[model samples]
Structure formats: structure tokens, C-alpha cells
Target: MKRLIAYIMLALSLAACKKQNVKDTGPTTVVTPPVTGIIDTSRTSWWQKAKFGMFIHWGVYSVPAGIYNGVDISDPGSGHYGSGEWIMHNLQIPVASYKEFAKQFNPTAYNPEEWVQLAKDAGMKYIVFTAKHHDGFAMYDTKYSDWNVVKATPYGKDVLRPLVDACRKYGLKIGIYYSQANDWINKGAANGGFWDVAQNGSMDDYIDKIAIPQVRELLSNYGDVLEIWWDIPDEMTTARAAKFSPVLALQPRTLTNNRLNQNWTGGDFDTPEQNITASSGGRPWESCMTMNDSWGYTKNDKNFKSSSTIIRNLIKVASLGGNYLLNVGPDANGKIPQPEISILKDLAGWMRINSESIYDTYASPFKFTPWGNATTKLTADGNTNIYLHIFNWPGGEKLHVPGVKNQLLSASMLANGKSVNGINDDTGITLDIPVGPVDNISSVIKMVVKGKLQVEVYEQGPEANGSFILSAAAADLHNPNGWDDIHVENEGNPNLGYWTNPWAYATWKIAVKTPGIYKVQAEIATEAGATVMVASVNGEAVQKTLTSTGGYGSYRLVTLGNLKIANSGSVTFTLAPDPGNWQPVNVRKVILTP
Candidate 1:
């Protein structure tokens, strides 16, 4: 009872802290006055607190449903496909033929209340629905264009109005996604290239006349547009992007993504699409990914990620201090597919049990952990609350948290509130966990630390045998070319793979106690020809030629000559690719033998 009270008090204090310096509108209502003067990061408090949101991608594309002329738009074998939403662009379908889809665009079964309720049940705090997709067909009643749901479709009503009302009724924030650029049906808008003669109009006129007016209606008609999602700023120059500023100024508190302009002017947060990017520079970011392969509904794209995958993805994003905007593509009938609904139901179950570990938690202090991820929250009494989301539970019932120097207060299972004990050592704290996991997907353990948190730097030290084993899992990846380009792959064993970028490298911090001459051996796998790799430590470096091992899955251990270490307490070992003669390889581990 006391612990629960402490948690409640901590949550209230954190809520107060999030709203401290931000502009106060009336009584914390959803709608606020238009943003005036300088807009700071405090405007993003609601969104930052909302760690998860639902992304809806519905449009005329659902009418065709990734199929055109009896061929799948994304059929790789036919060599004629892109995203389901870009079917018109990829097929270069004439406007006359594409406009025919609007005749069949009637979502008779779309219940706004049901949709909003699902999101709320799934623990999503907000919803970003597609008002207008790249197809240039609006899903709402737009006076600016006749190519809208009200005028063109059989169901002649504004879809967004009811959705907004439902959100307000259910206490879920509403957002609008408008394709600012690359409007396929609109004249004079950027359409990637001039595929059709009708698309050869001035881009500025489209922004000024159609785009800006539609944006104004979206912001005004909607009670409080909490988020304005701008997609594919292909030709959105600074001047053209600047034109939408005044319209957005009306809803000053609305959070805008980075896709508004090429320069990212007025963008409140970064939007990383389709992948979870590394974070911790303090800038707010959200990763928008689809449950399946396609953002829009594709009839054949049944490759939905499992409920476990979705839960883990959400946990991973929270651990990195970012939000996850999961996409759901409803069919033409306005019904979220049964599989998608099932996934959400499963997610709702998990969130019911383990959401406290996710909501309002900051990034983990530890760089990386093999078992799973961690999220932290500061308590009201200047202590720290750490949630250990264990994905891979230890078989021996011992969970080691390395490099933590903070004094442990209490540990408990998040699911059942059962007590868990911990022991602090020279390495870190180790918790004695239950024999079986509390939850099959992810079992969270809530831990409280006394006073301010403290952690030791993570460095691999020599074992009792006086030999150092630098595993790939412990290496800190340094890649300027984003997260997906070069990263740690977990096929069978976790190894640093997909190393195509020459500029990317991996570093492992080492603490050498008994320093002396050591023989180096590296476990690597490569399908390509011999590549030069430089392994450097303590100002001494050695170049090793990595020969092909027949296939990327095939692993081989090659010995690189010895190097003398005069004296060392802490040193960094960097394994970098030779840009001049580099071949893609997977590094499993590096071993030093005394």
C-alpha cells in the first residue's frame, strides 16, 4: 500500500513537471488559443506523454486494395509496384481512370465510436487519421476540391467530423494527416514527375489555393487539432512551406512533424518512418511503423507482426525515449481488418498489465542489455524508479544489471506486485527473479533506487584467465547513416551485421587489469571477397585481411598477430572498416588470448 501510494504521488509530480513551463490555456482543456510568440519544446508535452498513437491510412487506394487490372500493385515479379497508397503514381494511372475509384469509395461500416474505442482500449492516447492522401482524394467534405468524400463518393459525409467528435467524447486526442505535397489528382502539385498532363500546374498555386485552404478547414472544423501530419515534402521548398505557417498558427499548440518542409521549419518533432531509430540527444522523435508491410490496405499483404513483436517494439521505443505511432490500414468498407483488431486486442491485454512501465518513462541509462530493455522514471522524493522489461528471462533465475551504482530500495513484479529481492556487487545489481515469467510477452520488474541515480561506465574486463572476450553484443555501434543501414542483426546469434557503410564502425570499451602481449582472433562471416579491417587499441593498431567464408551465414575464426599492452586501466577497441577495400561482413566476437 505504501509503495502504491509512492507510485501515485510520483506520477502526479511528473505530470506537474511536464506542464510546468508550458503556456496555460483555460483548465487543461483539449482546445487552446492559437500559439503566439515563440513556440518552445513545452508545446509537445501532451504528445511526449502520449507514448503511443494510432495512425490510420485510409483513402481511395482501399477501393482498389493494392490491385489494378487484376495485378497486385506491389507484385515484385511483374516489376510494377510501389506502396499501396502510391498505386496511381507507380502505375501512372490516368486521372479519369483513377477518379472512377471515388465512385466506389463508400465506407458504410465505419463506426467512428468503435474505432476510437479500440484505440482507447489499446492504450493509445491519440489518433492521426488521413484527411487527404497522396492520391489527392480527400476523405472529408472539402469545399476547396470536388474530389472529396462529400462530393465525389457515394457516402457523401465528412468522415473526420464524427471521428473528431468520437475522440473528444472518448477523451482521445485527434490529429490530421494531410499530404502537403505530391498530390496525384490535384493540378499543379508535385507528383514526383509529370506522369500525366493534368499534373503540369504551378506548385505555388496549389499550396496557396487548395492545400492551404484545406489545411485551414482541417484545423478550424476540428475542435482541437492536436497533431498536423504532413507527408512527403518532395517539392515543398522553404518558401512554399512557409505559406502553411499562418494556417498552422491558428492551432499553435498542435504538434507538427518534420515532414512539413525540406528544411524542417516549424516541425515540433522528428518523425522516423518504418523503423525504431536510436535516440538520447534530447530531441523528441516518433517512429511511425506499420503492422504489416504496407501502410495502406493491401489485399495480399498478410505479413502482420505478431502481438509479441508489437509489444516488444513498443517497449523498445519507450526504452529509447521515443513514441511509437503504429499504423492500421482499414479496408474500403471502413472496417479495421480482423487480424489488425486481434493484434490490438492482444496489445490491449499486455498494456493493461504492463503499461505503467511504459507511460511517462524516460530512456534507460544503460547503453544496451542482452536480456531486454529498461525504462526509468524519477520519483517525487528525488529517487529513481526503474522498470526492467525482461524479454529473455534467465534460466537460472538470476538477472544481472551491469554498471549500476545506485542503492537499491525495493523491487516488485509489475504484473502481480510480488516482491523481488536484489543484491548489489562490484559489477552491478542482480535480481532473483521468479522461475516462470509473469507474462509471456514481456515481464516488467519495477525497482526503486535511493537518492540520485548513479551508474559506472560499461567496459569489458579480463576474466579470471587473464583473457578478454569482446562480444559483438557489447560493442557500441557508431553509424552516421541512420540505424537501419549498419546495425546488430539477430539471426541465430546476435552479431554486428549489415555493415555496408564504410564510415560506420563499432567500439567496445575495455578495462585491462593485467596488461601484456595478447594474441587477437576475430570471428567473422562474409560472402564477398577479402576485405581489410583495422582493429585498434591503446594507440596500437593491426590490419587484418578478412577472406570470404563462402556465405554470410558461415562463420570463421582468423588469428591476427599479437600486440603488446604496456600499461592500461581503461582503453577503447575500435573495429572499423577500410573504406578503400571494404566488404560487408558479420562480426560475432573478438577474442584476446594471453
Candidate 2:
């Protein structure tokens, strides 16, 4: 018996040796495909290349920084010093009461070159500063109104001009954030009437006389403005939007946010506040998020998101073919808080190593994995490169991709030039992921493929039965329903969110106010023969499961059991394969209805 055992051990050792020899033989060598087309050089593409930018929310609000007359005037509802400097407008503080802030608003140490240089050092390609905030105070020297930094304060300097000049000196693009709506001094605007008791005048005349001319001055004086970041155009009419459209005629290339008019006709791109949309694939979109809680400088605001979170957020936005406009509010003394500076420097270090994956890259063609997120961009040679952004590294050293038909040429870590080994099969692509926390922030994996991008989609159920219609291949589930096509979020982390094909997943969290027999359906396509899906309610596993049989598959009207959700309770739906091997599954819609 001992001899027999020894023989078996010898056989096992020989087998292991044989396998090692096969691996040592090395991967197959194949010629790469020829280049197809040049990159689209439209205005949209230029903006997309600018994956990361800086947003500065500075103005009269910096003077207050959440304090008025030695009293903490922070708003309790939204928090953070009553939206920075807008507290005066929001609280309806009388002009006489608020005018006192202008006296101490003298920023003696303010240097536009220092600020713009800091942004350039951080690898930011663009800078967007607040020219006029909701408080009706213009940061630039404007001919239209007396309520401006150049006219109202003791330090009567045109802040915007110097900043613009500094940006040009550093070879960075410059933009302006104008709050055309909710101006406190422009009586023609409806919200401006809040300060009516201070000045007696006609509102319409105030808008025509004060607001329009100020806008013209901003467009004419600023040299080669790249964008106009408009905000909160609530209750604005088409006529008002039409009035603003001509201003852009002055600079046809100037990109504007959707907020220029509530109708969204004037803006060049859809601006989603604080979030990225899933459906922004092959479209223009920007995510404007504040560093802390408010856009303007706020004192005693400690709720700033960690640098890791901010970096992850930027990666997600970039992965989905969207730009991230990160904001920073300087204190009343015109100094960026120490914490913000540290965060920016750290982010710049990270960008220095992994910028190739972000800068000048378009969206990826692969679907977002349940455990991670991916973005694809075509190289100059026309070969598509997919970047896998791992937010939460799995415990194991292997990543299992369900469906991929194209042969992989190479795989490497974006941070360090380390080669990764894996297997490619019809079942899926399984790569050896590095073990033990790779980075403090997210890590990117670049996968070079040989052929045109292809993907298979799977649906939870049928559309006719109960599934919501999936519009774009990519949609952001976290944003409001109509906003999915406008912004892109969930960029780098695959496990956190979902999008359509070539777009990240936009899953919906539907609340059942009234419970009844509801139909749940989804539209999906997959490359494999069969795929499985599971649904659950409040952590309780549901018995029903949907299956797809063939390529480019879908399901409709998969009825869920009668649900009785209490008013306070919530329901969640998730999708995955049964055998757990599926790739590039495009989920178009998930509809729930009685």
C-alpha cells in the first residue's frame, strides 16, 4: 500500500510539471488590426478630452463664510452656511443688513496667478469660476450693476480678469459660472423681488437694464471663454432662454449647461448636479459636484468627502465618457482651505500615474460588471481598449468575466507597469487579479482586444409584460428617470452600479407606495446559451427566476409574486447569470407596475 501511494504522488507531480511546461510555452502571437477612423474632432470631443476640471465658487459669499454680525447664520435644512454666500438671498436679508458684509470683504492676499497655478499643478485642464452668484454680486468688473466686487468692496479689483489671464498663461481653458436666475438685485427676475423693500422699482425694467448688459459684458470681456456654467434657471420661460441664446452667438464654441433655461434649449450639454448619468454614452455631459456641501466657501464645514471618495467619483465619471468638475470654495481671506489643498495634491499624484487611461479617452464598449465598472475607448489604430476600474477588489486573486469573444492582446495595471495573466474562453475571461489592497484609491486594468467590440444583453423580463423600456445602451439609475441620458456616473466601480451596453448600468430603486400584483420585466442580450436572473424584496429571496436561452436574448413579463410592502419598507432588484458565466450583457429596462 505504501508503494501504491508513492506511485500516485509521483503521477500527480508529473501532471503539475506538464501543466507548467504548457504555460511556459507563452501566449500566441497575432498581428493587430489596421486603423479605421480618426477621432471625432467636434466641440463635444474637445470637452471629453478634458476629463477633469476645477470649479471655483467664489464671490461675495466668501466674505461671509457662514458668519454674519458675529452670529452663525448657517441654514439648518440644507446645512453648510446657507449655501455659502447665497444665504443673504435665501434668507431674504435686507440690502441694508447684507450690505455691511461688503465692508470687510476686502481680500488683500488674493492672487489670481497663485490660484490658477495651483489648479494647473494639480493637472486640471480647465477652470470655472463663479462670476456672479445668486446674491447678485458679480466677481468681475461689470458696467451693469454697482453690486460687484470691483465696485462694492474696498479692494475694488476685477477678480475674473486676473484669473482668466492666469489661466491663459498656464495654457488652461477658462469658463464662467453665472447664476442668471435668482439674482437678488435684478428686480425683473421673480426671485429678486425678495429684496423689494430695500429698492422701489419695476422688476422687468431691472432685468432688461441690469442682467442683460452684465451678461453681454461677461461674454465680450472674457477672452475665448470655453464654457458658461449656468445654474438654477427655475421658472424661466422660452423667451428668456431665447434672450440668452444670442449671448452664445458671440462665442459659438462656448459650451453651456442645461440650466441656462428650464427648457434646456440654450445649453450645449446636460449638467447633472452632484451625480453622473448612465445614458451619457456617445453624448456630452458634465457632473458638477462640490468638494464639501456648498458651492461657495463655508467655515466650520467638516463634512467633506474623503480623497478616496472624490477620486473614485472622478474615475467613475471619466469611465462613462463624462467630465468631472470638482469644486473648491476659498475662505473669506481668499485661501483654499488646507484640507482641500492636500486632497487636490494627492489626487494629482494619482492622476500622474493613471492619466493615460482617462485623458483623451472615450467611453468603453464593455458592460459594467456586477463587481466592477469598465470604460472603452478606441486607440489611434482603431483597436478598442477597455479599462476595468476596480473600486472594491475581490478577496480572491482572480476576476471572472462572463462573456467575451475577442482575443486579448495584453493586460497591465495602469498604476504600475505589471503584467497580469488570465484565460480566455467562451464561458468567460478569467484574469488573475492582484491580491492584497492594490491602492488606497481605485485601480485600473487595461485590456487590449483584437476585434470590433461586441456584447450580449439580458433582460429581467418582457417589456409588454412588465419591464420598463431601456432607451440608451447606458443609463444612470441613481439620477431622476429623465436624466439618465444626460450625465454619466458610476464610472470606475463596476459593483456599485449598472448601465446599458457600452454604458454603465443605471438601476432603479422603485418604491411601492401601494402593494398589489405587479409585473417585473427586463430587456437583456447575452452571448451565451443560457443566463439566470434572481429577484428579492427587502432581503427575502423570491422563488421566481428568469432565464435567457440564446444570443442577444431578452425576457418580458416575468411576474413577481404578490408583494405587500409597508409604507416605510423598500424593495431592491438585482441581476446576474445562473451558472455565473456571461459577458457584455446589456440590460435595457426594468419595469414594475400593477
**Per-model lDDT:** 0.79, 0.62
lDDT of 2 by residue, 100-188 (tens): 78777888888888888778777789998888887778888888888888889998888889899999998999998888766766454
After superposition, candidate 1 runs with Cα above 4 Å error: 1-41, 263-266, 463-473, 478-492, 495-505, 513-567, 575-594
Residue 159: error of model 2 in Å? 0.8
**Candidate 1 lDDT (Cα, 0 to 1):** 0.79
For residues 151-181, could you state the per-residue lDDT of candidate 1 as single tens digits?
A: 9999998898999999999999998999998
TM-score of every candidate: 0.84, 0.73
